[model samples]
Target: MARNGRSERGATIIDVARRAGVSAMTVSRVINGRSSVRPETRAAVERAIEALAYTPNTAARSLVRSAELRIGIIYSNPSAAFMSEFLTGIYEEASSTGARLVLLKGEGGRPPAQAALKRFRKSALSGVILAPPLGETRSVLSAVRSWELPVAAIGAYDVDGVACVRIDDRSAAFEMTRHLLDLGHRKIGFVLGNPDQTASAERMAGFYAAIREVGGVEVKVAQGDFSYASGLVAGEQLLGGDERPTAIFASNDDMAAAIVSVAHRRHLDVPSELTVAGFDDTSAAVTLWPPLTTVHQPLRRLAAEALAAVTAAASAGSTVATCRAKILDHSIVKRESLAAPLGGADARSDPDA
Candidate 1:
């Protein structure tokens, strides 16, 4: 039966469940994706939805009246290059879903990008996606959890009330480190992300794991705040050693590029003399001096998933949950900057071995 618009009552939730051959609660949860539901069952529910001609009544006054929504995308980083790309992806995703994107770069006259974290409580948002320091900070997580608003973290942080949508930093870091090992690099150095960032901790775990797995290499690491300056500080440390790391893997491309600058200062040719690699595959990765071999983070997809979550959640008002945290995969891209430690970095390298 084709029901007309406006006054016509859409099919009830029970009808959808009946057609889908599942309980109404299952139908609700499948739509929500909050609790665990079988994939085939979820697909079947979706098909049943189409068959039942179901359309959510978001415009209904009662549905909209449950709770007012203010979605916030909060961050603590303000570096121009990395910050810009991250914000751009976030804005693109959030804006598309009709959620207002509050920059939350910090209020008051703060010195740098980090102070913004303190203001998340004051901001008017029902749901928030925290970036970096905000995503990982214990204080920030405490403040956010206290707010009782739904939050999706962009990295790996185990806050009780928060959900995470991020790559497995340990595995990604391990794989990247193994790549360098395959290139016959023994003295590999790592530049870590901000000490407070959980991803940094996980990434370090992976970096250490790679070194341990291969054995016979001196382990070394330097600290960075995931910024160009942080990279500079860490890069100098990487290069200053008497027995320098044959390859350096900075936590992110910004640091990697900074290390490239360090290499230039020492007149060491890239890849051939000293290889470098990074993560996040930001645009700056491509623009680097020989470019960088790095991990491809799916920022756009991540943002969209966050947006979809917030959008569905906000639209759900206070009627239980309508959406949840989603996971996505990252890839690795091999560019010019990473080659061999005087040898090649291909299958002949046998990273798994």
Candidate 2:
């Protein structure tokens, strides 16, 4: 139907094929994202489609389809390993549902968050999922509200009304510490992450809880910012303290590796002289000499759960408010990094003695 001839509802693919001088089948292949269409042919098909204002027939197809897709993932992390792994979950989940992952970079602080949320509305993304600390923020939560977008926060700490897919951080930490205590590690030191981080706080509570359960064992807690340098700085002080712990539980593997490095420099033998453990069984945990005992979080699986939850929420036409928390299990991975303290005079003796 020509624009001048009649008031047609819309142009069809036949109109594009006629203008491009290609068979209707070739035009259909290009439009459907099928392979084997030549570059020149694809280009001509696109041009003719634009010229005729031809949109796809997905509307009719969608009526028969049982799925709604195009999921949006929001990450406030600096482009890094953790974020990359999180996105892998998003992609895998989206693929299973015949959807695409529309990732949003929310790296900057509050101002960036506002701008990112604003830009999010301009796109055709269906639902949004928040990762970690970002999901725990007041500003981000408020922004999510103002944007009128469906948002699910993965790894949320305080979820009064928020939807989250996270693990029991406090319980995980408690269990890991209890495992060490059961192995006869009484005088254990802790290298913690930033106080502002909810996981760090929860993990610290777990360590202290274990100490309280056994009664009378000293707890030396060092502050770290979840970085190698922070670990190095804090670890040195803890290692050189008057009552050095026989075993040190770092908040994460990176800091644990730093503790291991510091121990090596001081000529302290691992497991034989001192034992070290860490949380968040990151890659470095297994690579350290003798490796590290840590709590293994199902990062990828948790991520998939978060994405799937968001997908389900959007597909069900429910507000993100309707979504609830999901808890994943964690495991304790033991390697050579843990052992009974060296006997008597050689084992973690007091500096003042």
TM-score of each: 0.77, 0.73
Question: Between which residue pairs do clashes occur in model 2?
Answer: none
The TM-score of candidate 2 is 0.73
TM-score of 1: 0.77
Report clash pairs, candidate 1.
Answer: none
Q: Which ranges of candidate 2 are over 4 A from the true structure? A: 1-68, 77-81, 106-111, 344-353
Give a tens-digit lDDT track for model 1, residues 226-334.
8888898998888997888779998988899999999999999998989899988888798868999998787666665554454444454432222233457877789
The 0-to-1 C-alpha lDDT of every candidate, in the order given, reads: 0.71, 0.71
Best by TM-score: 1
- Model 1 error, position 82 (Å): 3.1
